[model samples]
Target: MSRIGKQPVALPDGVTASVSGQTIEVKGPKATKSFTATDDVTLEVQDGVVVVTPRGKSKRARQQWGMTRTIVANLVHGAKDVFKKELEIRGVGYRAQMQGNTLKLNLGYSHDVDFDVPEGVTVTAPKPTELVVEGTDKQLVGQVAANIRDWRRPEPYKGKGIRYKGEYIFQKEGKKK
Candidate 1:
């Protein structure tokens, strides 16, 4: 039995969910999101909750069962509330700013790195060294943050780079004398 798959996803007061074949649509004040599960799983809305079940006892069906349920839950949560990811620039010269729809970054590179913000996600530079990514889709928000961090991943030498907020970097000993 799949623990997560067995749990019903409850719809909040202002949120509504609809089921059509393999697709489930969740609508809320913030946004509306839909997900289509594989044929190995079934989707249904009962009362104020959404349930997912396996179509068969096969291993693939069982795997899809839990994954489908979690996807539906994410749709519900995303429809009702936005997801956010924060990043911090740690190097001395590293910084970030928003120019129109682009994010201009100075990550100790010869040329400033220009990151074009996608349509669904919004990137904001609250401070010179702080960046906040927000969107209705959790995956998009996280992916954008990760892409920004990839430019200058935190290193152990001096921990100089871009990193998620509150992320810890284990510093290694400097070159032996």
Candidate 2:
């Protein structure tokens, strides 16, 4: 039994949802997002709530039951509000800034790194060492933050690199004589 799949997703005020075949579309003030569920699960909207149920008792159907529900819920949330991810540069010379539509990064490299901002997502650097990635889609926002962090992941010794805000790095002891 999938407990999570049984719970219905409620549509908040100013948010609306529609069902067309296997696809569900959620419309809100900020944006509209749609999701197409696999045949293993059934999607329906009833009395302003979205429901998901597995078509059969097979393993694959059960595996998709909960996942389908979560995806539908994410679409509802994404349409209503923006997902944000914050990144902090820990290195001494590492920093980032927005130049028009591009994000200029200085991660102690010989040449500066530039990242192009994608549509529906906004990358802003209020401070040189701080970055905020905002977008309607949670997946895109997280992916952008991960790509930025991948440039220079924090090391254990000095903890020098880019990392998510409030994330802790396990420091290792330096070489001893």
Q: What lDDT does each candidate get?
A: 0.92, 0.92
Error of 2 at 52 (Å): 0.5
List candidate 1 stretches off by more than 4 Å.
none
Q: Report the lDDT tens digits of candidate 2 across residue range 27-91.
A: 99999998889999999889989999999999999989999998888888888888999999988
Each prediction's RMSD to truth:
0.7, 0.8
Model 1 error, position 86 (Å): 0.7
lDDT for each residue of candidate 1 in 15-131, tens digit (9 for 90 to 100): 999888888889999998988889999998999999898998999999999999888888889988999998989888788999999999998889999999998899989899999
lDDT of model 2 at position 41? 95
